[model samples]
Target: MNCLIIDDEPLAIDIIAAHCAHHSDIKVIDTCCMAMEAFQALHQYEIDLIFLDINMPVVSGLNFLKSLKEPPAVILTTAYPDYALEGYELNVVDYLLKPISLERFNMAIDKVRQRLALPKPAVADTASVRNLSAAQSGPVKNFIFIKSNGKLVKLDFSDIHYIEGMKDYLKIYTHDKVHVIHQTMKNMEEQLPESLFRRVHKSYIIALNAIKQIDGNCIETEKGGVPLSSTYRDALLKTIEK
Candidate 1:
């Protein structure tokens, strides 16, 4: 994989480059200290992977990933374990905490290689699109079965207002109830329809029919007004305007 390291620490970058050199398949294309530098490199080069750091001066790793229209597979390298769960929620390939060992690094790279080996799925995700459209096309009995805290909860599609993303869990907001599930927002996003649900933030997704109001940097869904993320502000506006 042709990779780039977006980290402020020079030593960290050097170490990562050294470790990656041991593997013939992984190549360090360039090293950047900030998002802009990486952004420029992205335009200049055909990079396949990004070794991003969570804690940076201005734009963090997560925020950068959120900004991309087509993000490459990322492997987060950070000192903070607390953000590991959150990183996974973004569907990053791997999370390697600081003081990375060769074995651990190898394991993470192997996982990425395995994913790269998988066959590419077809573009026809239309069957799912039609089902979701049918739900709102008319008064259809639309619902989804979700695994909550300890049991399976069947929630009507219209009952949900939006979802809140916690580290490794999600808070689902129904008409009069909020249920927390030990699953990532990305997992829930895959099951929910894009027509009814839109990911308005890195940490939020809202049902189009349940929004009461939309304020700058926030949303007033049926559950309550939740803060909107700057990372997804533009995307949400585009989706809601239509």
Candidate 2:
């Protein structure tokens, strides 16, 4: 994928570029010190991914992302971890805390590759159906692998109470802890078997077996109540009735 690095720090840009060099599939098209320059680069090149810093002169990276009608995949690079939620809400591919390690940077790039592999919604039929069927009937996947703290962590599927989407990542709540992973909601939804999980909101997919009750537009799980959107409520009800 053609990539862009947008950061005011020369060292930061160089670090990212060096990481990209390790991967043959990724190429650094250009580096911009400010958002405006990055904006111009976006118009000039068919950029597929971006390593963006949250703070920059004149125009912040977030504002520049907001300005795009159809933005390329973005991985936010910032020193502060506080902006993670906001960055995810913007549909970024991943959030990388500054002074990023090669391992962490590689993990973020893996997410970008996965996103690029996904077919657009309009043409996603064949792959979606195949993945759903495999998930449901292919030797029950009791566990799933999630990237956390620069490594792959395995969690039992049954241990999950619910999953909340924060743009490009998922907050997976379990009985004992919450695991945050860089992934899109749609991608996660498809990987989960429909027999055990249900998408109840634009941002949530719950493990049906973990649900205790349904009240109004919410599902009560052992962890807590998760909102059920009007768009997905009826389908969830229909699934339960079956």
Candidate 3:
């Protein structure tokens, strides 16, 4: 994927470019520090994606995106979490916060790949899929690959105690460590198997088996207590009952 980095800060541009280097499929076509320069670059190159900062001098990133007649897939890179909703309203591929981690950057690129219908890097084991299907009566495969620290980390569903939502990112707490990935709660909810995980609050999703106890509005896990919102309380109870 040919990507353009548009941000006023040179450091921010350098960071994003460095991350993009890790993915062989992604190429940094050019970098633009101002909106006008980016506008020209977009016209000149067949750009596939953009990492844009919202707080640019003169023409803001949001406004520049609006000005495009046919904007390419965009991942908003900004320090302000408040612009997340507005960025979504503009149909950005993903919203990434400042000090973007390599893991987070990879997750955003995955979204762009999906949006463009590009083939994903081989992560799933096809042999496992066939083997599980042939068995016909065993537990479903329950592991996922998440980008962490510039590499793909395989995590078993059983290891995850809970997931904490942080605006455009998610903090996945497992028995050993915490992994931060760029993903929305809604996306994570859909991706996770409903039978194994349940949304107990607006900002939390707990592994059903990991919940040790429920008290008032809290659900206790091995690591810590997670909030159980009234909105999801009844549904959670019903899920547990079954």
Candidate 4:
């Protein structure tokens, strides 16, 4: 993936570029010392991700990001943690507090790759649309492709034990491995088949067959106990009875 690093500090730019060099998949297309130079770079190249500093002279990074109607995946790098919430609010892929460690930098890039890999929603034009019959379509799919460690990994529905939500990411628990994915809980709920999975809490989704017991406000699974919210308790019970 092509990357653009934007920072006022020469050292900061060099540090990020050095880190980018470690990843074979990441190509450092250009580094800009200011927002205007960064703007020119954006027009000149096809950048997949941007390493941006939150605090810069004249125009702040967040303000620069606001100007773009559609931006490539952004990872905010800053000395201050105050703008972290604001950065995530702007839909940045990840927030890295400087001085950024190589491990942390790798984590951020993984998120960027995943965000770039996510399928874009199709825009249909009725004038040029083609119709397909039901008989021509294939059978139902029982697996889903999730971005894990910068690659799309196919996972079967039956292997999912449960899912736990972080602020802007999800921990998908399978029988043996836990996959971290950049996605919202609402989007995951919509994508998962309702018959196999159920949201037991705002932060938890348990596979119906994976539930060993529903003890009080907790749902037990082989992995661990998940909190059951009152809002979804009735619905879970109703589904189980059916």
Candidate 5:
């Protein structure tokens, strides 16, 4: 999908462009620093999606969108939370706040993809429903963003070895280094994809593919060993068997 970025701030434009560079499906065709420039770009290229900043000089993003006869899918970017309601009223695909995380940006892109692929209003059939279900489960995201040390850290599922839970904080063991973040084991477990991670113990969650061996109640990863509780061992075994 071709994307156009419209933001007055150069840093904001750079951030969005950097995030767009990560997605193989999105191609950023043009970037505009002003609403007028964006209007010109719209006429020049076939834009499928837009990353629009809400507060800008002259015409606001919402006003510019309203002026367009048929605006493309827009994901509003803003520092203020006050514009959220107004942005939604314009039927934007998603709303992203300033200093957007890669994970959140990817989610917004996914929403744009889903919206663009939607069929017109019609009676749903069994086959169509099945196809929709398949589309919704198209592919699992390969990475996640973890907030640690006052910044968002992106980690690929493959790079994670295991996670050890401490009181009020969790330690994530990865290929290169360990990240200590203020998070609960349950919350971390919920965030990770079940296909890649498993809750082996109340205090541990290990990447399924990272498990080198399982000896009795201990699961060994490349980094270190994690205790596998009897409560979750059977479920882990079931998954491995499948």
Candidate 6:
């Protein structure tokens, strides 16, 4: 996807755009300090995404996004909370705070792209569905190869006690080590099979076999403790109800 960055600060522009640069799927074609410069680029080019900053000179960034006729997928990059409500009211993809980590940026960017490129629901054939279920019943190997920093660590599913969602990453807590990966809680949940892990919160997923105990909103596992949401509490109760 082609992206355009509209930020007033040079450093802020570099931080956000540099991360986008590393991802091969994204190409940041232009960087503008003001709305007018961006307008010229938009006139002659097609932009799929915009990383917009809320605080800028003369014309504010939020105002600029609102004034567009047909805006691209926008991500509000700012250091303030005062404008978040209004930004969401305008239907922004994701709101990111300042001092942004590369991991957080990657998560937010993937989310917006996912939102923009929502796939059509597959029309299922009864034959195909049946085949899938028959195949899915087998005990699939539950493992994840995580590339953290510069090392690839293969984690066995049984060894993972639980996982915690950080600002832009997940801390996969296993018996031996905690491996961090640049991924959303939502993405990780999809990769992990139900027979192995369950979402206990908006921010946590745990291996059922590895759970040591449950206390209120928290789960005690071999690695450490993590929190669960009230909504998922009933589900947990069902497991231990017997």
**Pick by lDDT: which candidate is best?**
3
For every model shown, the clashing-pair count is 0, 0, 0, 0, 0, 0
Which candidate model has the greater lDDT, 1 or 3? 3
Per-residue lDDT over 161-239 for candidate 3, one digit per residue giving the tens place of the 0 to 100 score = 9999999889999999999977667656644667799999999999999999999999998899999999999999998
Per-candidate local distance difference test: 0.76, 0.80, 0.82, 0.79, 0.81, 0.75
TM-scores for all predictions: 0.48, 0.49, 0.51, 0.49, 0.50, 0.49
Query: Over all chains combined, what TM-score does candidate 3 have?
Result: 0.51
Candidate 2's residue-wise lDDT over 67-176, tens digit each? 98899999999878988888989999999986677678878888887899932223235555444344433455566666677675777778889999997778999999
User: Residue 136 in candidate 2 has what lDDT?
Assistant: 30
- Candidate 5 lDDT: 0.81
Per-residue error (Å), model 2, residue 234: 68
| lDDT of prediction 2 | 0.80
TM-score of 5: 0.50
Which scores greater on lDDT, model 3 or model 4? 3
Which candidate order results from sorting by lDDT in descending order? Answer: 3, 5, 2, 4, 1, 6
Clashing pairs in 1: none
User: Worst ten-residue run, lDDT, model 3?
Assistant: 129-138
CA lDDT, candidate 4, residue 191: 52
Off by over 4 Å in 6: 118-242
Worst 10 residues of 4 by lDDT: 128-137
What is model 3's C-alpha RMSD? 12.5
Model 3 segments beyond 4 Å from truth?
A: 122-242
RMSD of each: 17.4, 13.5, 12.5, 14.2, 8.8, 12.2
Please give, for residues 29-100, the per-residue lDDT of candidate 4 as tens digits: 888878999999999999989999988899999999999888999999997999988898999999998666
